[model samples]
Target: MDSTSGPLSGIVVADLSRVLAGPYGTMLLADMGATVIKIESRQGDDTRAWMPPVLDGKSTYYMSINRNKRSVALDFNDPEDLETARRIIGRADVVVENFKPGSLAKYNLDYATIAATQPEVVYASITGFGTAGGGALPGYDLMVQAISGLMDLTGSPETEGFRSGVAIFDVITGLHTTIGILAALREREHTGRGQLVETNLLSSAQSGLVNQTAGYLLSGSVPERMGNEHPSIYPYEPFPTAQGPLIIAVGNDGQFRRLCNVLGIPGIAADERFCTPPLRSRNRTELRPILVDALSTNDAQSWFDLLTEQNVPAAPINSIAQGIDYAESIGLDPVVRVGPAGEMPGIRHPIGFSRTPARYDLLPPDLDADREHILNWLGAESRLAAQSRA
Candidate 1:
């Protein structure tokens, strides 16, 4: 696909961030058609070496978030390379970085430094924590999960708190950073000046906690781990069926009524002890066995179909592969082939646009893969500037 066909077609992004959060955000911009130039150190992004899941010796983890971008490696210790890096930032419409706070100040690549000369440039900074007392601490997702109370709310009451299987906070921070960048860009359209857009893992984690945190603040009660059960919702977790586990989510009394009808237990929906949402949630222990026994009458797949047909939210617990297959079976097209030759498999961008669709023309680049092209482009711009001066 042609990059110019995307909504962010004319935008040029300088991506100085590495690893998950930074790269994931920039990849979203690239998906929407920004010309993202990934500036890395000579050693490359730390994720490049993260292995065990490699695609032809390439890091699948790196490829997952670095597609549709060009790579240029520059060492800050080298003055010429530093200058080139600055030039890339100078020419970019948007600059994204995820270094620790103040680390880029010495190199004159911080938002303040860049915004002083190029007030029209949208600068986005992602950090582990904000640039305050927590600035010195490293911002890994696991650490953020523990610090933000997510781990505490994860596992069952008897088990030790567990980290999520994915780097959820990093992903959340990246998404928040992307939204900030887009908002700043929109504001620049009206004001003709850009501002610093900042996001941190801890802050994003707190925001991601959403209702869990809000509930604690309002009621003065700390939430505990429930292991696959939602804190405020009953029948919102997995239940055993004849064949496998099935998830039944009943958000309101209407859904509960529908679910009960589908399970051939319509009378349970009217039971005084489990009538309202609050009552059902409060009396989940008494309600769970009743629902479980009813669900045991059929296989998970059968129950899923019956409940779904009745407009009740239900699903069979699927593995990753099964999930992908399920999405495809429903014509969602969850996977796409990327790379120049379309040989590499990738997850499709989640958003769907009517006028301008996301593109996957480029694959994740090897270290410094596009350095020569980037330098040549920079040189051409310099030549044009000299001519304009002459």
Candidate 2:
């Protein structure tokens, strides 16, 4: 990213984080123009070895979240390198880490230690669980999905619980961490002090579950899986078309009317059993076969175009490649080239800012690509601090 283009231009982030959650969070800060120094161990971040989807033998998993940041590898066990890390943290505006509870105390890189030295530091810690009762358990995304009741609600009740295809909770926790860090930075503007921010996969997952979790909490009724069917809205799931399945989301009476008109069954919208959304939801079994029969007359894409033209929400399900192509067709530049070589394809960050737009100037760095430069920069900053104190 351009060093001076974003609102966070002058900010420096000491990213002592690893794996998905922490790296993902730091990447957000980096995209926003923070000078994020990703301090990896001597062996590098673990994701570098996560393979099968690699480019030029480099893990795409690692590259996806590590862009717009410089890297420096250091071994905490080495006394000299430990001091270097401490100095780097002591001078950084923000510090992000995902170490387990009390694990950084030996290196004196814990939030308390760094915060004591750099009073205005915004420190963030991501864990599988908080530092309380579940501190010792590993923070794997799959396990958190299972524990957080997400896997239970995912698939049909007839089959065993299945985890989501992606590491959903990790991404949510990372987003929560980014929000916390941004909020902390905002709070620092007024208070002239910083605070320790903490987020975990379990807590984020609970919040992310949203309506399903709320249903159980408010009514004391646990929700179970209903396959592709929505618990509330009728005709919100996919139906078979002549060619392939198409999703028809009939949100309201008008959309329902439009869908019926496009399906050549306008009378279904006025049918007593399916007139209202609640009524349609209550009588889905009666309505499903009619929709199935009507939808079967045309291909998915044909129905998709006809329903969309009539202002009804409908779409032919597309694979990931097709989805990206659709986004490109609509003028959304969803993919970007990163690295100095400009050969790596990375997904663009979703948010848009009119004035302080995100920068994509840097590709993900090689392991310790900026080590010598980083050490020199640290030394210069330390000397400047000493001079100011003297």
TM-score of each: 0.98, 0.97
lDDT (0-100) at residue 65 of candidate 2?
A: 94
> Candidate 1: which stretches are off by over 4 Å?
1-3
Span of ten consecutive residues with least summed lDDT in model 2: 1-10
Error of 2 at 121 (Å): 0.8
For candidate 2, lDDT tens digit of each residue in 1-390?
A: 134688789899999999999999899888888899999999999999999688899998998899999898989999988887886787688999999999998888888877776789999999998899999989999999999998888888798888998999999999999999999999999999999999999999999999999999999989898888888899999999898999988889999988898899999999999999999999999999999999889899888888878889988788999999999988999998766676677888778899998877788889999888888887787788889999
RMSD of 2: 1.4
Give candidate 2 regions above 4 Å deviation. Answer: 386-390
Best by TM-score: 1
Model 2, C-alpha of 79: deviation from truth (Å): 0.5
